[model samples]
Structures are given as C-alpha cells and as structure tokens.
Target chain A: MDWQKLISFITVLVTLFLIVRSEIKKYKLRKTRPCGSDCNCAVLKEVSLKKLK
Target chain B: MNYFAIIGNPNCGKTTIFNELTGLRQKVGNYPGVTVEKKEGKILFKDGTEITLLDLPGTYSLTANSPDEKIVSDILLRKRIDIQRPEGIVCVVDASNLERNLYLVSQIIDQRFPLIIVLNMVDVAEDTGLIIDVGKLSKLLGVSVIKTVGIKRKGIDELKRAIQGKFQVSTAVRQWKLPEIVREEHEELTQLLIKHNSVKEDVAVYDAAALLSSPKQLKEFKDELKPEILDHVLLDHQRLESLGYDRHSIFVKSRIEWVRSICSEVVSIGEKKKSYTDIIDSIATHKFWGYIIFLTLMILMFQSIFTWATIPMNFISKGFDWIGYQLGALIPHGDLHDLIILGAVRGVGAVVTFLPQILLLFLFLGVLEDTGYMARAAFIMDRLMNKVGLHGKAFIPMLSSFACAIPGIMATRTIENPRDRLVTMMVAPLMSCSARLPVYSLLIAAFIPNLLVFGFWNLQGIVMISLYMLGLVMALLMAFIFKKTILKGKTPDFIMELPPYRLPSLKNILIQMWERSVLFLKKAGTIILGVSIILWFLATYPKIENGNPSEKLAHSFIGQAGQFIEPLMKPLGFDWKIDISILSSLLQREVFVSSISTIYNIQNADDKTVSLKSQMQKDLDTSTGLPRFTILTAICIMVYYVLAMQCMSTLTVVKRETNSWKWPFFQFAYMTGLAYLVTFIVYRVGLSFI
Candidate 1:
C-alpha cells in the first residue's frame, strides 16, 4: 500500500476506535453505578450515574 | 472563597439573577447522579474575597417530590459527598407571589443556615400594584431581604452587599413549630441521629425534622443509615399519622400559615389593575384563538427556517467550494487531497450550512421561553396532551425537540412522572430537528416542482412546513399509542406557574444562539469529523482496476453494502446510492446530503447553484432507466426521516436517559419500522396515482 493509503487507514481506525470507546465506557459505567437521585425516571441516567461516580 | 447556593421556585427569576451576578463566569454540569444542571459561577466581593455560587434547580419546597427537589434537599442537608455544605444561602423569592414564595423561605429558615432573601421581580410586583416592604419582611423573618429585579439588574448591588456581609446565626428564623405528637417524634429522631453520630449537633434538628416529616427524604442518607434505623423512622412516621396529624399537612399547613403571617405584615396593594400580560394572555390562551395563534407561529417559524436561511446557506456552500479550490491549488491532487476536499471540507460544509436555520429556531424559541409564553403554550396544549396520556409539562420538552432532541430529552426532567418522561423521550426524536433540514431541502429542491400556488405561495415552503407538521402529528400520535401500550401509566396533573410576559432580552437571545452554534460546531468537530472520514474510507476502498471512477465506486465497500440493502429500499423508491446515504446517515441525519455529495463526486457539492440538484435530477436508475428521484420519492424520503430515529447521538442520549438498552433499541425498532411501513405505502400509492 502507498503512504497515503497507510495514513488514511490509520486515521479511520483511530476515529472508529474513539467512537466505540465512548459507547463502551458508557455501557460499563451504567452497569456499575446507580443513579444519584432516587427518582425512577432514567432521563440522562448515564450522565447522572457518571456524575455520581 | 466560600460556596453559596441560590434556590427558588421555577419562573421566579432565579436564573436571571444567576446570569446577572455571574455574567459569563458560569460553568454548567449535571448534579451528582442526576441530569439537573449544576451551575457554578464566581463572584468577587469588593473586599477581595471570592464567593462561588451554585445555582440549584428550582424547587417548590424542601420536600423531595422530584429529582430536582431531591438534589436541593441533598445539598442543603449536606448529604452529597461530592459537594461541601454551602457556607450561606440566597433564597430567591418572587415578590409578586410573596406568600407562596415565602413557603420555601420558611423551610430554609428551619435549616438555620446563614440566609439572605432575594425578593426577585420586585418591579413586576410593583406593576401589579403590590408593594413589598423588604425591610419589614426581613425584620419579621429575622433575615436580610434585598429587593431586586433580576432581569433589570435592579438592586443587584444591594444583593451583592448582603452576600458579602457576615451572616448572622439567628435564633428566631424557625417561626413555625411542629405539633405536640410530631415534635415528640422529631426529638426522638434527633436523639437517635446524635447518638449514632449520623449528623452534627446543629444539623440534628433539621435532619430529624426532615426524616420524621418526610420519610422519602431519608433516601438522601441511604448510605449512612442502617435498614433497621430506616424502618424505625418509617414506623415512627406511621405512628405520627396514626395519632391523627398527617405528616405532609403538618409541615405544609404550618409553613403556609407562617408565610401568610409574614406577608400580612410586609406586603400591601396600592391598586389591583389588569396588567398588559393579563390582556395578552386572554387572547393567547383562548381556546380557539390560542390554537390559531400557535399554528400561525409554528408556520412562520418553519417558513423562516426554510426561506430565510437560503442566502446564508448558499454563502456557506460557496465558501466550501472556495476552500476546495484553494486546497486543490495548494496540495498535490492525490488520495490525501481527495480525502481532505471530498471527505472533510464537504462534510463540514453540509453541517455548517444548517447553522442559519438552527440559530433562527433557537432565536424564536428563546423569545417564546424568555417572554414566558412557552409556559402558556404548554398550558394550552395540556388539554390535548391529557387526551394522549401525557402531561402538559411535556409540551415544553416537545417544543424544544423541534430545535434538537438532545436538549429536548434533557428537558424531560421537568416532567415529574417517570413513565410520561420516558414516553416523551421516545417520541422527541420524531420532531424534525435542524439536522434533518439539509436532507429534506436537498431532496425537495431536486425533486419537488418549484411551482407557486396563486403566484404567491411557494410550493417548496409549504412542503417544508408539511414535513415539520407531519413529524409533530406523528410524535403526538405515537406518544398517545406508547402511553396506551408499552409505557402506560397515570399522567401526572400538570401544575405550571405562568410568569408575566416581558420583552425577551436581546442579549440573552444572542447568548443562547451563540451557545447552540458552539455546541453544533463542537459536534461537527468531533463526531461528524470521525463519521465523515470513516464513511469516506468505506466509499473509497476496494477499488476496481481499469474502470470508470463511478464504476469503481460501485464496487467499493459501502457501495456493496448499499447494493445489499437495495431490495429492502426498492418499495420506498430509493436506489442503491440513496440506500447507502441512509445507512451512513444513521450516525447523523445531515450526513445524508454530504454522503450523497461524496458518492456523486460533486466537487463543491453545494445544494444551491443547482449543481447537486441537477446531478440528482439527471441521475438514471440502473433498472428502470428513469430519473432516480421523483416527487413521490422525495415525499417518501422525507416521510422516512420524519418517522425514523436516524441519529446515534440521540440514541446515546436515549440510552443514558432511559438507563437501559431496552428503551433506546425499542425506540430504534419502532421508529424504523414505522418509517419503512409508511414510506412503502406512500411510494406505492403515489406510483399508482401518477
């Protein structure tokens, strides 16, 4: 493969990794943490859980 | 530096005061374990001391009825481990509603924190012919009261002075006493708390009163208390109720009485004249006229977003072309150049061009919200929302959804009922957000006839409005169905305070617009940048040897995927190229226009100047050999977007909001299914008629 192709490939991989990283982090965090407020409404619960941690 | 918290009722101008005091020094984050905003800002005292102000969520009382109220309760009780107990308190009360506003003040007095009462909206109170004696009120409550009009910056200096002054430890702030039975229970709980070292000596009384008064508020100290202790508290609460005085009424009735007594001494009316807001609300809230006014306002908003944004959008489109040309000259024409020009610049251009409409949408929304008409709109829509098993409070969130669903979903925190909030969250994405504008406009310009009705009304404008209204009607209908089916529950009775109308502050509107634009750009920089490059790689790889570039693209990875999905989209009148755009755009709706631009190999790819539109119009179907896009096809595409949850960011937020994969995936499935079914019928029936 040419140098251009190599750089482009690496960038795409990095981008994909970053995107997937956020989703996975959220998933792991959601499982471990309970929401701070006792309200049963889950609106923004992931962020709420993250804040609690 | 010390920490102080600003708490007040909703629509009591608490935010206005926060903004005036802090100006641009504010930082916003979610409160611990909740989506409620934790706004912190720094204020420098004249004596060179600094104070950090935390703007807590507006609450009616210390009672933890909602998540927002719980946050306030937790913070004031010093239960949250992440935050320190604030050194002082600024209780913002509306002078116009002094009696009700003082109810919160009385509760705060029970805590006996260093307190200052900020009587906000004193001008409004005066206009209503209600004169408030701030000094007398302060004397009676045994606290410092500063009268300020937050929006006008009136008495702000005095408020600052009061905050800097040494707070007094008053012995007489708690005027209302509990009944003999409840007082005995409170003392027993206080003794238990002190014995167990559950609270400090001073906090024992407040904690005991809170725990005995409302058992649910004990959740604030769930980590520290044993199960048996909690059960004991509940048992005591039941005993108090069994002894004939209800816990809620015992607290509420005494508090109301205290507030009334204070107001009677310090408040008087000069005259009771009908204010301008009263005159306006008569028509704006009228059953028939209200609906008409609302429809007219929505139509005007949609029309402006469609027609007024065109000039700047064209300019933004051309700006991208100029950048592309400059890059062509500066960089050697190769894979790097192609990727930068086609993938990055064009992708950014597509998203940036939607800025004008987004700003306009926020501009109108800010005006509605700032003028207090947004609450009125909700009040009017509550009757209809009731029919759909949704509360009227859901209307503000749904209205916000028209701008974008992220904030709209976040706004669902205002809806107290869990089920209703979830249902609102589910249907919010069905509102045609600004991201969908580029897709609709592109398809409409390419396919829909530009004929004007009666040589006056533009057909394209009407089509745009129809698409928006279609989303609204569908969202309401689906919300109704969802409420009846999967998320069925009792819709809470909506109680909203309608603040008097004021002219929307131009500075606030501009600041809101600026913030939204920055958020949009931030997304473009991060998620869109990543998605754009990845999609470009997918569309460019697996090159064909010694063939036409278009033919080479056909064999690319994304091209192959599109072809794989072609059969499924055939009923909706979408070709493989359109199908590919649909797949890529699931990450973001605006990506559809850019992905199509990249696939078609249009250099500038501006939707204006007829380049992209003409390309789309002349494109032929491989099988039918007819123009790829028709009026029917455009309608079908728009319908699909109107129904589909084609935004990953929205879904991520949904997962966060619902705290489960069950709801977001269910949202994806139901919205996608409905989109496909509706598009299929629209396309098939239209083909037969045409």
Candidate 2:
C-alpha cells in the first residue's frame, strides 16, 4: 500500500476505536450513573423512591 | 480537611458567595433520592488550611416538608452516611429580607452547630432605607456576623477569615421558651431518643420537635427505632393535643416571636422610598401589561436570534468553505481527501455555524435568571399552568426545558407531589431544546422568506417563533392530558418569592454562556465528527470503479439502508437521503444538520465552494423535475423535529428519574407517534394548499 493509504487506514482505525470506546464508556456510565456524565440526574431513583414512601 | 456547609433560603445569594469563595474549583452532582444539586468546592486559605465548602440546596427551614429541606436536615443531623457531617455551618441570609430570612436561621441555630451568619446583599438592604447594626445583631444571635455583598466580592476576606478561624458553638441563641407543658413533653421525648436511638445530645431536642410535628419522619423512624421510643413520641403528641396547644404551632410561633423581637431590636428603618424593582414590577407583573411585555420580549428575542447571528454565522460558513477548498487542492482526489473535506469539515461546520444562536439563547436565559425575572415569569405562568392542572413550580422546569430537558427534568424535584412531578417529566421534552435550533434555523433560513411582515417583524423570525410556540402549546396540551387522564391530580396552590430586580452580573452571564458554548463545541467535535466519518465511509466504500458519484452512492451501504426506510418516510415528503438523516439524528437532534451536510457534500463533491443551503436549494427531484425541498417540505421537517423524542440522553434521564423503563418508553412512543402523525397531516394539508 502507498504511504497515504497507510495513513488514511490508521486514521480510520483510530476513529473507529475512539467511537467504540466512547459508546462503551457511556453505556457503563449510564448503568452506574444513569444520567450520563455531565448531567446532575444521577441518583434520582433513590429520590423517587423516597417520594413514593 | 475540615468541612463546612453553606445553607440559606432560596434567593439569598448563597450560590454567589459559594462561587466567590471557590472560584473554578467546584463539582456538581445530584444528592441521592432527591433532585437537589450537590455543589462542593475547595476553599484554599493563605496559610494552607484547606476547607471543603458544600453549597447545600437552598431551603427555608429544617421542617423537612420537601426533599430539599429533608436533605439539609439530614446533613445537619449527621444522618446521611454517604456525606460527612460538616464541622461547622455558614448560614447565609438576605439582609434586605431579614425578618423573613431570620426564620430559617433560627431553625439552624437549633441544630447547635458552630455557625456564622453571613449577611449577604447588605447593599440592597441599605438602598431600601434599612440600617442593621451588625455588631448588635451578632451579639444578640451569639454568632459572628460578616456583612457582605456577594456579587461585588465585598466582605469576602472577612467571611473567609471567619471560616478558617476557631469556631464557637453558641447556646444563647435558643432563648425562646416553649409553654411549660410542651417543654416537659419535648424533654421526655428528647431523653427517650437519646437513650434509645443513640441520637446526639446536641441535636436530640431538634429531632424530638421535628418528629412530633412531621409524621413523615416519624414513619421513617418506625422501622429502626425501638417501639418504646415510638410509643413515647405518640404519647407526647397526644398529650400536647389534649391541651389547647397545636404541636406544630408552638414551635413555629415561639420561634417567630423570638426572631421578631431580635429584628425589632437590631433593625431600624429610615425615610422610605420605592425601589426600582417595585417600580418595574408594577408593569412587569401586572395582569394585562405583563402578558403584553412578555409577548413583546419573546418576539424581540426570536428576531434578534436570527438578525444578530447572521453575520457571525456567515463568517464561519465562509471560513469552513475556504478551508474545504484548500484541503481539496492540497490532497489528491481520493478517499482520504473525501474523508477530510466532505465528511469531517462539512459535518462539523454545519453544526458549528449555529454557535451564535446557541450562545444568544444561553445569554438571554442567563440574563433572565440573574435579573430575577425568571421567577417572575414563573409567577406569571402560574395561572395558565393551573388552568392546565399543573403547579406554578412546574413552569420553571418547563422554562428550563427550553434550554435542555435533562436539567429541566432534574429540576422537577421541587414539586413535592409525585403525580405532579411525573406529569411534568412526561411533557418537558416537548419544549424545543437548544439541540433542535440547528434544524429549525437551517430550514427556516433556507425556505422561509426574510421580508418584513407589516413593515416590522421579519417573516423568517415569525416562522421561527411559530415553531417554538407550536412546541410550547403542544407541551402544555400533553401536560393537560396527562394530568386529566393518566396521572390525575389537582393543581396545588402556588407560592413563589420574587427577588428584587438587580442589574445582571455580566461576569456570571458570560461564564454561563462560555460553559454552554464549550459543551456545544465539544459535542460537535466528538459525536458529530464521529458520525460524520462513519457516514462518509458507508457512502464511499464498495466503490463502483466505473460509475458516477450518484450511482456509487446509490449502491453504497448507507444508500441501501436509507432506501429500506424511504417507503416509511415518503408520506412526509422525505426521500432516502432525508431518511438517513432522521435515523442518524436519533442519537441527538443536532446530528440531523450534520448528516444532511455530509450527504450533500458527497453528492456535490465537484463543487466544494457552494454553501449547504444553496446546494440544498439546487437539489431537484428526478421524477417531478422540480426543487426537492419546497416550503411545504421544510415546514413538515420543522414540525417533525419539534415534536419528536429524538434524544437518547433525555430518554435515559426520564428512566432514571422515574426509576422505571415504563415511563421513558411510554414517553418515546407517544412523542414519536405524535411527531409522525403531525408531520403527515402537515405534508398532506400543505400539498393541498399549493
């Protein structure tokens, strides 16, 4: 392969990796935090439960 | 590090003081079980003594009627194992509203923590012809008092010095005497709690009084406490009721009387004059003029958003176009160049060009909030909201949803009733969040005429405002339906305190604008950029070596997927290309613009200098031999975006807030179903008019 093709290939790979990593991180964070990272919506379930009580 | 909590009533300038003390060193999170925000920051002193200052959610008292009050009470009583109890407390109060502010301070004093009273907004008090003898007030309250104007950074040094100084717990503040019979019962209950519940000596009296009045807390302690303590509390409550004394009123009345005595002694009024706030509020909150002013402001804001943003948006658009032209020249015509020029630049630029609109929206919201007009807006909206069976408190969250739905949903915690809160959450996403602005702005600017309407209002601005009003009207309609049918409830009485109008702090407004702008830019660089590259690859690969660009795109992976969905979208006047954009935008609404830009870039690769708008205008339907996107189609698209539940983050937050998947899924199904039905109707009806 030519040098330009090699560079493009690596860039695509890096892009794919970052996208996949971000999705995984977001999924795990959602499971644990539920509101995504930046929002202040985490721990709402406990509050909702208290409201129910 | 020593921990000190800052607690105050709402609108007491507590947050401003907290920001002044801990500039950029702050973290925001949610306290468990309530939507109250947990804001913590580190205050570093000159001598290297580090103190962690927690900005507790603003509450009137430790009465625990709402979650905010409960959280404050819990923290002060050291009941929350998740957070360490503060070693001391800094109780902030509005000096201008001293008589009412002192009520909460009296309750905090009962908690018996080493406390300091920071008299905030003292300048506002002085302006109203009120003079407070700070020294005499401090001696009477038995705590150190530091006068401050939090917004101006006045008295910050002395406030910090007090925080770092040796703390003193004053016993003299609780001189208010309860009736003898009630005092005997309270003492007995306090002893029982101390012995049986292991309650601390300093807070047992406060807890005993709280338990007697609040049945919610009594029920909470039922499971953990020994039955003897429960029986004792019940018996004490009965004994107090047997007499002519109301258990709750005794504590409240006695405290108020004492606070009133203290205020009368330390505060003196000079020659009175009406302030600017009162002068303005006469019209701002008047029944008839208020609505007119609000409508005029809405019109002005929408008009300015379009007119003021044009220059900067054009500059950004031209800059991106020039860069794309340069990149096309610098590299060979191949996949690498296509990825850079068509995919990344076009996609990011399409979204980035809308930054001015986003910033303007945030700036207006900031000014409204800082000038205390937002609260008045809520007060004004209360009657209409009540007509729809929603509390006035719900209007603030709805207003906030105009910026974004996540924080708006989180802000629903202030509504104490579960049904009302749930109903608010179910409809908040219908408000057009900032994410939808790009889609609306792009379509409006391209399709709607920019001529003056009646020689005053811009036609484009009117269309934009119509779309926003459509979202709001639909939201209120949904809220009414939810309240009447599924989550039926009565609208509770609405009471809100309107803070006096003050000049907005430019520094604070700019900081908010900068923070929100950076968030927008970050999303553009990351999620939008990623989706752009992926879409570009899907459109470019499996290349037909001998075919034209359109032919190659038609046979690509993305093209096939879009074709699969094209039949479903045809009723709305959308083709395969628009179908792909709709599908990609499910992750976030702004991605719709980026997806469209990327698709157009790939199709018109030979002409890199044409703007996206011009390219879109030039697109022709092969079958009809007419322009692809007509005014009808643009209106349909805008209507669809206004109602669609297209954001994943909002869905996740709804799930978290409800603690069940049932509500979020229900919300999604209804919103999307509504969007599809409305767009179809709009398309069919619009076509008839043509």
Best by lDDT: 2
B66 Cα displacement, candidate 1 (Å) = 1.3
Clash pairs, candidate 1, are A42-B657, A44-B657
Candidate 2 is scored at a TM of: 0.95
Residue A2 displacement (Å), model 2: 5.9
* DockQ, candidate 1, vs. native dimer: 0.19
Looking at model 1 chain B, report the run of 10 residues with the lowest lDDT sum: B25-34
Over A1-53, each residue of candidate 1 has an lDDT whose tens digit, in order, gives 77777777888888899978865765555433322222122322323322211
lDDT at position B247, candidate 2: 82
Q: In angstroms, what RMSD does candidate 1 have relative to the true structure?
A: 4.8
lDDT of 1 by residue, B1-690 (tens): 378888887667776788777764221211111125556678887778888888777887776665556678777876677767788888899888888888887777877788888998888888899998877877887878888987778999888887888465545566776677777777777888888866776578777766776656676666777677677788997797788877766767876877788788988888866799889999999999998998878777766776788899889879887987798779776676667777877777767777887888888877877777777888889898899888787777787787788777777776666777788888888988878877888887678777777776678878988998898888899999998888788887877777788888777778878877887787677767777787788888887677666667778898889889999898898888889888888877887877777776532333323456777777776667888878888899899989998987677777776666778899999999999998999988998999
User: Each candidate: what lDDT?
Assistant: 0.76, 0.83
Which DockQ value does candidate 2 get? Answer: 0.36
TM-score of chain A of each: 0.45, 0.64
Please report how far candidate 2 places residue B418 from its true position, in Å: 1.6
True contacts kept of 2: 0.22
